[model samples]
Target: MAGNVTVDRTIVRAVTVFAMLNLLVTLNNTPSRSWMYPAGLGALGCVLLTLSVLASLRDCFRPVPTWRGIRVLTYISLGLMAAHCLTVRDLSPRDYPPLLHACGVIILTAAAAFPLPTGCVLMGTYAVGFFFVRLQSLTVGQALTECLVLLVSGATGLLLVALVRRTVSIVSTRSDLTQQEARATARALAQARERARWDGLVHDKILGALRNAAAGDSRRQASNAQTLAREALAAFRADTHSDAPTALARKLEQVADALGLECEIDIKQDQISSEVLDVLEAAAVEALTNVARHAGTPRVSVRAVIGQAAALLIISDRGRGFESQAPGQRAGLKTMKARMEAIGGQLDVRSTIGAGTAVTLSWSHEQPSWLTVLWDVRVFAPMIAIGAVDVILNVGLGLTRPARLFIPWLNPVLAAVVIGFNIAIAVCPRRPRLGWMLAACCVPLPAVSVLNLVTYGDAGWRYWAAGALTPAVGALSFRFRSSLGVSCCVASLLVLMVSEAILGRTSWAPVLGPFPVSLGVALVGGMLRRGLDGATAALSCENVRLAEQVRQAAGIAERNAEISRRRTALALDILPMLELIAGQGPLSVSEATECRLLEAAARDNLVAATLVNDAIAASARAARGRGAEVVFRCADNAQPHAGLRIFRSLVEQICATIGAGSSARFVWNGSGRDFIGTAVVLGHEASAIRAVVESVAHSGLLTVTCDEDSVLIQMRTH
Candidate 1:
């Protein structure tokens, strides 16, 4: 704020400096034979300069509210200079008071135009005083010329100041807008860099291990490793790449290739901006990901278009689709929907689990340039069309009271249709191109009206008044466009003329109706249309939000259900083995039933736990393996404990179920007899593996692998 004040003060000083310079130039141009006149003029210049400096300083500390007194003082100084210029007898008529008087007038004009409060008043008053001092020496012609020149100069200066102010405002606004765009671009670049780093590290380590396993003649191990490797690779690759805003279709193609899925892209290029590209990219990616993961289909098609002031993107997969409205079924789908909305776009999904899924994203480009033109045309087009139609119908039913009474209502209806047509064109899925053609049609309508007016005088006024309502009605109906505002202004002027004709001039009353009725009709129609349009837009936004919420809720529920099913299967397998063990006596030695139950329970529990662990490991490996290095190791610490031998048996069974090749072991010297601190290695597939390991780690006994097989981690009983 202080900086702004400082800058403002600098601007005022610059203006004062320019004003003083112009004053000096005026003094130099003024001719005076006597040295006294020149001397007096120089003194005035010095005094003006001194006053300007002091005013600038004072303005910085605190602004002066009034400049009346300062103005009077400057006027007194100019009066002395003017007197000197007037009384110089040695100078010629053109050189003496006339020329000098013109100079004084210019200086005074600059003062008035400068926007310097105290300075302008002082300069203006001084100019007036100077003129007053020379008043006795001037003739009537000279005085008139002085007044004329002063008026012209002041007007010119004022015009320049207004132009400067407008230019500054425009430049400042543009600068601020550019800065905001720059900041946004920087943020996007940062996100892209972070994704690239994540992908690079995940791919190098996890997939490489899978390749080695396959080459070493371990086919069974290779297949299992490959599945984990593929998951990791997919995550890494997906994380690394992003869709460029303007080339969404291209990005979809890249993603399809990476996933080894077939994809078709059909998109229009014209009028495509980053905003449109982003919406399409989001919709296409989500749809394609679902197809790859769940559709059980190989092919996807994407189509995009820009038309009729709207943009559309559609993605369809030939994979298994899901229930259209099942609760908790589609989180990915819901996400795609939310993205479309933020940009004022809409998304609709159609799917059946067996058939395939199709997703459509649509949005209007909402061009400001077009809106302005549409507004203008909307107001006048229907108005003129309705008027032309009105004239033809009115003439057909000439001088009939019924025709006159019904025509007003009919005129508005036809006008409304014209407006509806424009709105349809604006909101249509296809881009509208009637811009030039609309202009062409409007050109001759006014000429035809003028010809009718010339042919029939008072009768023409009635036709004119009726025709005026066309533009007025059109303006009210499609006032969303800028064209409507201009049309309204033009229509208002026309109505004013009509009002004058009907009420002020009784001569035209026979041909025209009352002023109040026309005015009221125009006002009410415009307001009504505006209200309806606003309500419609608000409702559309609300509906989209509600749909998104419903989709999200349904998706959450479905995921929860899938988790429950998996847990139930594991529980059923473990429950029977536990019951058999309980049936045996505590001290049963080598009992076959007890031994079989223990073995079976261990296998069942280990298999269930292993499946869960491997799935988690695979998911994490996939995440880290995307564009990065990964490693896996098995620990040699699988042993049964006396008290919890079931738990130890479970670990061994789990290791076998998940396969042994992906494990790592570490030896660490401990002060105690407990070997639980031994390190066991997981995978270098995904960074998420760290999270899985940490989650399962217990204080008494657990796997801990850190520092590249050098350190041991285990659960400590404290």
Candidate 2:
């Protein structure tokens, strides 16, 4: 808190020092006198300086509250400066009054404390005082320029305060999120442990009592039953509330105890954020659930390590693993991965059939610096090529000059060096110091410009304009930090600034004037760099997320096709007998009853075969409505935990394509290294079946084999 407060007051302190020092400068430079008064104007100036110094000292510890007399003192001080300005006997059109500088500083200091509107008042007050003095004592142009510059300085002071306040707010917000996450985690972990304990108690005590009562059922067991009943009540009474473990090991141990898994907590760091730990722990639970439920009762191992840079959690089990992209498994992976991403972490799963499945979850506060410099250079190659060409062309033009600058071949040598650096950086840019490439781009112009100014008395503005190349390059490479970009550009400009004095010029406006533009370029670079950082992170997250979705859709489509084939088979078995009875003559009561019974039984089979997929349901309804025999069987699918929802739309498409006489068979082959769903369709010609296979096979998931009698689609669920 103290540090944040100090940061907020930095601008105020700086403005105070600026104001006080400029007052001293005024005392040294001003020539005004007050002989008629008991004390001269110089003595009065000293008194005012002493007061300002005292006020500054008080303000160092904390800002002066508005209720205090600081505002009034400041007003009085400005009034005194104005009085001094008015007393000046000689004023030149070209010279500015020293008091104007003092007024500017005082206004700047005021801006740091006051709200915007109040700061405006302070600025206006100072400007009015200075204006009153300047109107009588100096030329109109001098007065206007002083007022404008002073106002601009005051606005800059306000901007400093605003920036500081914003920084403090942003820091506070992040801290709050971290703290809140910790509290939320504590509550959730406590609840989970409490629930686990209750469950463990019931399983151990109450269920054991019931089993004991059931086992001893003879008359000799009545006393044993009574004893069991009493024991159950006693156990329930004794299972009182206890504190849930929250420290890392105890918490994880409790989880392992409840879940019946082996747990290891490797604490590399003394402390970890609860927010990060919560995310990791939750993801581990999801992974372990998948392993136990799908991995054929394999032994589960859970491990967690909290490190300095990041935390890692691993859950492994040797189980009968299915394809990682199998819809059921993919859904769990996606859920866990999304949880990790929310906390800026990565979640990954690796599995091979009959070997094992391992789910790894990791999170870090800072992004890992994973720079592919070659890729970055590839992206910027065109810009670098253009810059290289410009330098070469400039050198070619400079070669036409009959008179040499510094050396006979200096221009071409500098150009060659610059172009070499540009090409080298473009092909293989280095990470962490990418900004330094600007120095190479800067060298050609400044070296040639300075050499020309030395060799010839007349130097063109074109020579100075060439110096801007460094900043332009810096702007283009804004994503790089100071070491690689902005600082190097500024260094090149500083060389030109020093060169102007070495060339023996009285004024170095040509060199010094461009410094502000350099700063502007750096500002632009910083902003662009910041924006791209955010965009890069968001793009990466979206890429993996989209890949998961695409894999999921493919899995769903394959499942739906397989379900439709099952529905068709079930419909074939019963449909024709009903059709015969409807078309032919009247039947006996037994025949009619038998037909109704068969129809009812067929309808029940179809309902039981209905898949839990939305798209497959709609498609099945449409196919049946079109006089197609659809059969559904529970045996046609396996891997109940797999996340595939059989949508009817895919089946409808196939039925419509195959026409009215089609009979399909779906064989669910999940007892293997990968899930195999094969659909065999009859009544479609070999050519049509071949075409359908060609269209869906492009996905690299399904294989189609067609013969004269039937077409088979084998989809390998990945």
Candidate 3:
């Protein structure tokens, strides 16, 4: 797609070169013309051929060819070939002039350069005119045979160009699909990483401090609680600038001191971005906090190693460890894993009971594979089809008049060898050197064998296989380099000329008839390869650029969302509670318990605000009052904003089904097309909830599962 214009220009230039060669060959054989036409008419024919070549040259450089120019060139080329045949005077029926060979060049040029309808019209006009013109000099059967040869040439040209265009379109479509999938994957990962960061910040920093302060008992404990409150406030106000680089060792030391733990820190390399460093630091802090709370230890080790294009961080603690698959501990570990994965990193956690725990985070720059962008089967399929067609047509034509062959048995054998070599070329397109060798061995064998086997008397028709098979040399163009393909074409032309000279032919028209067509085909193939290569490179670079931009925008959006949520919590929850505590000196036992409940409610809102609408909130409050624990966990920010009316009704139904002394945990997971929400209920046997979940499932919007002690309801997020 990127180099379409370049490919078009390459095709036009090939056609122009073919026209020039045809014109030159026609002029070279003019003195040997057996027909007695006027000298002035011959000069006019020459002028038309020159004008057509010049017009083709002009079309080569322009983006779109002038339709009028194409029409004029077509008329002149077809008119000259017909005029040469019609104006014959005192010439033998079998002694056709050389100018008639120009018809093949004209038909091919029309097919390659003209629009489809116009090209078909021009080709049809040439076919009818040539048939009638040949009737003036030869019998109907011979005239029809020549007309068939000319038409086959045109059809082959048209099919080749059509296949090329179809393959280009397919490649473009595939490239677009690949880019779309890459962008979608990137966006999903970005959203997951942002969710992980926010979930950890809210759960570990804000909610943990609020719970501690509300449960404080002694005077020293209250002072410590107040300190935690101030620290939480400072965290809400803290902002990170990610446009600069960060030193890993210094950050880890500060994290260890803030947690009041003895930490052994080691740093090997420090060339990392601020964004990546932030993820590493947050993961390290979470690991250290886990050690302090669950590991029953105060000392830990933090190590970071950064390379030219990759980084790794490891946090280890020797304490009272637990099984890695413990149920309640997975939430924090899952958050850290998602955080690492969002930045194309991996997180590995290992622990043994009464031993230790180790968490490793690693990331690196990855490059896309070149094989995906370069080689395609679509391009090869067309080439193989065209090559097979060429072999079939030539073989069919050669067998048409077996009696005319000097040695019919030997001819088919040689033709088979040539076909086999062509097949070799088709199959070994990636191995150009080997293909060129096979092409060299095949080119001269066909030209010499076909020309020598068939007796030449009627203007080269008996040996038409020699010229018709010339396009087979062009098949090498798809496999070999451009220069090598052109050389093969030239070699085939030389072999044809030498074989024709051995047959005592004085004119060069028959020898040069199909050479220009073969050369043009080779040029088109070379241009196609170059165009696709350029397009692939451009697409790869663009994908890299787009991924970087998406990551940056995702980071900015994540920061902005976090800031907004923090501001809301400060103004409506934390700040008001702090003011009340300050005004009253200290909270009573009942007030502290109320504060804990309020903090838990705020935490639930931060987790899944979309799921906790006014109706759902009221229902959840009533369930809580009935001694039920209602929790919400959202993995990503895929809120069903457009389907809120439906979501609210469904959520309210599920909430009402919750009985006393029960527990419900609602979780939102996935993003984009696969987004879903599920609610797990335990500790109660409720037939009403099963009925409600099954009713929604029957409508195709939800899926319900029930166990002896629990029920799960899942629904798509819009």
Query: Each prediction's TM-score against the native?
Result: 0.30, 0.41, 0.66
Per candidate, the number of residue pairs that clash is 60, 19, 0
Clash list (residue pairs), candidate 3: none
By TM-score, the better pick of 2 and 3 is: 3
- What tens-digit string does per-residue lDDT give for candidate 3 at 1-718? 1325544555566566666777787787666663456766766677777787787677766765343444466677777766765676555576556666665576556666666676677777778877777777767876777676666667666666555555556666766676677667666666666666666665555555566568766564465456555655655666543567667677777767766778998879756766677777777777877776687888898888887579888889898878867622355676677677777788988888888888888989676643234333464565456556656665665566535666657766776776766666665656766866776775676465546554555434444454545555565665557666777777766776777677777445445555566676677666655655554555556656766776667667766776676677457656666545534445787668766766667666665665676577778766775667888776644555444455556667767777677888876654536446777888665567787766655457676788777887766664
Q: 1 or 2: which has the higher TM-score? A: 2
Residue runs of model 2 more than 4 Å from their true location after superposition? 1-8, 27-39, 63-73, 94-96, 115-118, 135-138, 158-349, 359-718
Superposed Cα deviation of residue 693, candidate 1 (Å): 33
RMSD of 1: 22.7
Which order, best to worst by lDDT? 3, 2, 1
Over all chains combined, what TM-score does candidate 3 have? 0.66
Ranking by TM-score: 3, 2, 1
lDDT of 3 at 483: 65
Model 1: what TM-score?
0.30
How much lDDT does each candidate structure score? 0.42, 0.50, 0.65
